[model samples]
Target: MKAPSTHPIKPATSIPALLKTAFVNALIALVLFSLMIGIRTEAGSSGQLTYWTRFGDLASIVAAVFGGSIVIELLRQWIGPTGAEKLVPPAVQSGISFIGRYLAPALLIFTLLVPVMFYNQRYILDLAILVLTYVMLGWGLNVVVGLAGLLDLGYVAFYAVGAYSYGLLATNFGWSFWICLPLAGILAAFWGVLLGFPVLRLRGDYLAIVTLAFGEIIRLVIINWQDLTGGPNGVSGIPRPSFFGIPLDNSDDGLAARLGIEYSPTHRIVFLFYLILALALLTNWATIRLRRLPIGRAWEALREDEVACRALGINTTTTKLTAFATGAMFGGFAGAFFATRQGFISPESFTFQESALVLAIVVLGGMGSQLGVALAALAMIGGFELFRSLESYRMLVFGMAMVLIMIWRPRGLIGHRAPTVYLTKAQAISSDLVKEGHG
Candidate 1:
């Protein structure tokens, strides 16, 4: 018998094949960007529609696409289809695992020091607060999408509910932030249950469609119900959160006066920073603790295989309802904070785009991984601000970056799924072992 081959055969790289692939990609790009990029339309001095051409920019983009396609094709040929993982050295894998082990604690420590480190920088403080807001939102959605394996396209509906709940309550009844906070959450949870009842029987794309419609419906209602939601003009002059009933203003009754310290606007900013920080920490802690409980595990099981979950006698209905209610409660909490932080809110603030961004954060961060979601939120929210100077090219760069990340890490930045309960020792489970869930 002939001796077995010592190594696997590699596919031959052909110049013609590479060129062909590049040409096809470049042609597609040319067709797509021709109208979108090559032509710009605007209302001119005469108040009529005007158009201009930017063929140079269009040509440049097509060329870039051509070059990128060829480079990608060459890399694919060099690495071989099944050997992409081999590109990562064993030592690098070990280092990644090590970083993953301690990253959460390190991030928490750094986050706590943010206000002190940049105490005087108002811009940084505001940006940090924005990042933390999304972090809280991500953590809330993580419970539904990441842990419970439910796809929620109408999450912004609950967010709107919470904001409007607080806006209407505080504006009409003159309620304090502390009192409205819990009420906002309770109201959102009620809406969540209302949403959950109809969607309990649906899964996958059908569920997504229904939830999306629900979000649009809520926005429409808000727009048409001018008397209550203030129509498109939005609710304004919402009260800010006080330091336990003491305002942060320069008035004699304010916190600064009470403490015998000089009043400055920075105090309010700092207070708001720590307030959201505390709320985010509560979300993180609650989620971690919940995962060990029976209900949490049931949610996970339902995420993995609803059929198997039912076979094991799990109450899928209650499991799903609790997940929705729990997620919506945190979303409501964040919404309340948002309204108080901005002192205004409108239906425009809670849109499908917001839902998509939060969902992208959860998916890009890796489902079920809190640290991953937090890190993803920072990158996405911060990255957008980082590219603000790019203006026109900002979205192009962002889209490219997202595509590259997905290519390199399709399962997400941190794809490992740690077991809620392990026999010998707790271990990180590979993405391959985790199911993406039916719902």
Candidate 2:
């Protein structure tokens, strides 16, 4: 005979209790949102400060927050952290895979045709170029942060290295962009190795601090090395890229002239778009190929458990250096492209903010996810562009969105992680199965 369990089951949250909690949460949100959005300040006609209050804004925020709180409460009761398995079902995984196959080609084709589709709209084309640039940067950082599980807060140092390398080489030697691109990557990779050697024993916050200091050191050096780096004035008159050695200017030797067509500014813009697109594609392709190699597997193993990886006889030194070098190489390429595109180089462009944004893209996209990186870059950058009109509330909205995303998808937007090496048939793994950056 079996004995019945003596423990009592917990009772469900009462409706009144749920309502009370929601109301309290909404009240707190109302107070915070009111302070953020209810008041406005501007210069008056008499050159004095003026203040305005919007009751309507407060009411809207209260209602929205109240509604949001109620929904969150219900969701918490239904499927909290303990119910993670419900978040990623086998059916959902299959659907995602099905959509991915078609979505990738469709996206590539759309991106390829964007300049042509909006040929007359230079603004849109310019935005596309900016998006692709970030995508390349995100992919590059993913190698170190996502694959290698190295927290690099000074990635922009490598970016600056590449940009300055190209600028100095081109301005001093009159070298073309094509010649300086690879050289820039090499210089940046060398710096990456140099940085990697010293931080070989460090991890976590220590490693992050060292990388951050490295970035600041590079910036300060650039500022103080006025004779060589031009200090704050920066280097200008850097050459623009050419089409197979054909210049893009209005001269007779320009591509527009050589093609027997009247030179339109659109020609240069189109060429720049394709050039960045090609670079971004190359970055993505290389990352995908690398993930299947032995080194790549070693990176995943190291990311999951460094001690265990060393126990298995993996050389952590070479692995770490390779990750840094690979990431720096791509960053350098992007930096050189940026310099040539802008026809200028400056330390202001590579800042901690730039590193943060790249890191955000890697984290928000889901660490080690190539497709997620591209999608996240488009979302974050496009969101910024879209909300530019809401100048005052843009950051508040962006911050709120990020918080909500973290709450909803803590791991990342595309939270599922595909297996590095499957013995039998491969399948997407739930992010809940392991911490990020692990296999």
Candidate 3:
């Protein structure tokens, strides 16, 4: 006869416990929303503050939060921790994996066709350009924060450096955009190296703080240095990028005139769209290629465990510097493109917010995931415009969406860590198996 187990079976959570948790959560929501959502504040004509209450809206939000809390708790208890994977059937997981394999190539094809399909819609083209710009930025930062596992909060410094480099060279020396582009990238890489040297020994929170200070320092220097950087007013009259050496303007040498087509200003928009698309493609290609190389493998190892990387005799210093330089070079390219696109350069354009947004794309997409970053950029940027009609509630909705995504997919949209190198066949290493790096 078999002996029965002596261990007690775990008890399910009681209804009262669930309600208590919900009530506590609702109370916290009430306190937090009381001032921000419940009350509307404005400055009166006489310089005094005026206020109004929206207790109806406040009560509705609190009640919803309470209900949501209970539902979440119930779901959590049902799923348990290890049950998350089991929730999705094996067939569904196989389908998702199959879709992921083709998703990148399909996305690329769609992006290439965007300008052609939306040739007449100027707004769509412009929005596509904006999305592609962020896509490039996200890919560039992905090298550092994603693959290398380095937390960078001052990436905008490189962006500003690139923009200013192109602006000054073109404006002062009368150099063409093509001539200044490489120079801007080089200068930004140099700055990246400088940043790498100082923070060589720093990691985690310390690294983030130092990088943030570096970005603020660069911004402040641009603001205070009126002679060279033009101070806060920034530099204007920056030349636009040309198709080859020919301009996109209305002159006889303009692209439209040369092509014997009417100059409708849409030509310039389409050209800019293609230009950014090409740059973004180049960024994606280069990143993908580098991931298969030895240095790329080093970055992955470093990300997994710095101690293990050192024990394996990899030079962490060079790895970190190369990651920064490579990432910065791409950022510089995007920044130079931005300066030309806008026909102006300003410190205000490269703010901390830009860095945050790019970082968010990288994180939300999946760290070290090229396709994930691109998709995230599209969602965050294009989705923002989609909610324009929501007005004041747009940000709230956006935030709620992000929160829900985090709750469901904490590792990101595509959290799988595909092995850079594998025997027999390359398979994605589960995120749970990968260490997120020390730095």
Candidate 4:
């Protein structure tokens, strides 16, 4: 009787427990959604579902899952130790306790990414290659526009030079891509220096105008130089990439046939993917190396203050040339890859829009950061891919996204963090232990 009196009859309400239940339910719903997709086509006695219908069903399931997850997430507002504190997660439930924290995000990414791998389009991979190429272009141009504070509108001119250079050598002289690639970069650099010479006396908007004029001039020359550039018809059948002198075509038991891999447009695309990946990586590595060096620092200084950079005994002329040359070289690199990838070239490939996009990437990525540019490229180019189905409306949607990102994170993703800089001591220690990365 005394023990019975000590007990108070009341409903046990645990908010944290409630939240956990909601989270679990949401996860179950997501799993169910995946299962729905895996088994929907096999369902009997149901209306036939096409791709769009299945897509709609999957989307509905996803929405349901998200709705449940949101309820659990809203409970996060009560994240302290108080009347409801016990109902909340304890101390973040660190380590294994918060396993879902990491897995949930990864699952979301995989759900989105895995769909594309099966989209059965070569251009999706091509799109990846294109983004990587532009990322390289943006990084290279960041050195000039972001670091050196020089607005180069003629950046694409060097690209045209590089592409045509590769195209001509590889086709006419029968040069290998290996030899033509460096030559393309060198030729682009030479053009960069040439462009730099006259623009040395210019600055700011005036410099940009001059560079813009130069780019137009180069394109016009290419279009008019029919004797050399094949005129408006441009160059075609320029040759595809070869693997160790083995062409990736059916003619020489090219990649697919020889390797016992089915011949599809993607094999060559995959090769291009790796090649461009290597080039983008090389450009990133070189940029990082240059940043820690005196010249790289000098470029940054020039970006911050041209007068001060000059006062510090740094040659503004040489720095500007180096920036232009470096940026142009990367553009040239992209142009060469483009030429090789398409096996064709025309004035259309080198345009002000290309220059503008690259510049926007650097600006959006926060001028001096490599990772920033990469993110910007992903946002711009990748966004285009994501909305490829949008067709005509894609540009509008893309512009809106950029505006939103600028509104939210103006300094750009990762913002002026440095090509390689330290924040916390722990980060520094861990960074050394783990290798420096672009991320």
All candidates' lDDT scores? 0.90, 0.87, 0.89, 0.75
lDDT score of residue 342 within candidate 3 = 92
What TM-score fits each model?
A: 0.91, 0.86, 0.91, 0.69
lDDT string for model 4 (96-167, tens) is 225534653564354245325744677567777788889888888887887677888777898899999999
Please give the range of 10 consecutive residues that has the lowest summed lDDT in model 3: 1-10
For lDDT, candidate 2 versus 4, the one ahead is 2
Pairs that collide in candidate 1 are none
Task: Give the per-residue lDDT digits (tens) of candidate 2, residues 135-238.
Answer: 99999999999889898889999999999999999999999888999999999999999999998678888899999999899998998899999998899999
Candidate 3 residues 349-413, lDDT tens each?
Answer: 87899889999999999898888898899999999989999999999999999998888788888
Model 1 has an lDDT value of 0.90
The numbered model that scores best in lDDT is 1
- Kindly report which residue stretches of model 4 are placed more than 4 angstroms away from their true locations once superposed: 1-120, 257-262, 419-439
**Pairs in steric clash, model 3:** none
lDDT of candidate model 4 versus the reference:
0.75
Model 3 lDDT on a 0 to 1 scale = 0.89
For model 2, the stretches where C-alpha displacement exceeds 4 angstroms are: 1-87, 420-424, 437-439
Residue 96, candidate 4: alpha-carbon lDDT: 28
Q: How many backbone clashes does candidate 3 have?
A: 0
